[model samples]
Target: MTPITSFFRNLEAKCCAACGQMIHEQAESYATECAPCQEQASFDAYKYYHQKR
Candidate 1:
């Protein structure tokens, strides 16, 4: 497979785009924390959930 295709195929095992840390596909669906981005996403989710309630 082409490098690009291979990348997407195993996207689940890919590292974080910002921190270069490994990320699981299952975690990605929920909350995959990028070392660099830290908890930014979790905070965002918290906000969204609270707003929706």
Candidate 2:
């Protein structure tokens, strides 16, 4: 296997707060600022759906 593949294989997994999408450790750098969500880590589901207006 290639080093890049192996590196990705060892990465941890996480879910995006904004989109509920599976995010990998290697992608964290980019995922943290998801273009679709405007990079708002503060705009999670809880904040969007549960917070008082």
Q: Who wins the TM-score comparison?
A: 1
Q: What is the C-alpha lDDT of each candidate?
A: 0.65, 0.62
Off by over 4 Å in 2: 15-29, 33-53
Q: Against the true structure, candidate 2 has what lDDT?
A: 0.62
TM of each candidate vs. truth: 0.36, 0.31
Instruction: Tell me the number of clashing residue pairs for each predicted model.
Output: 0, 0
Best by lDDT: 1
Every candidate's CA RMSD = 7.0, 7.0
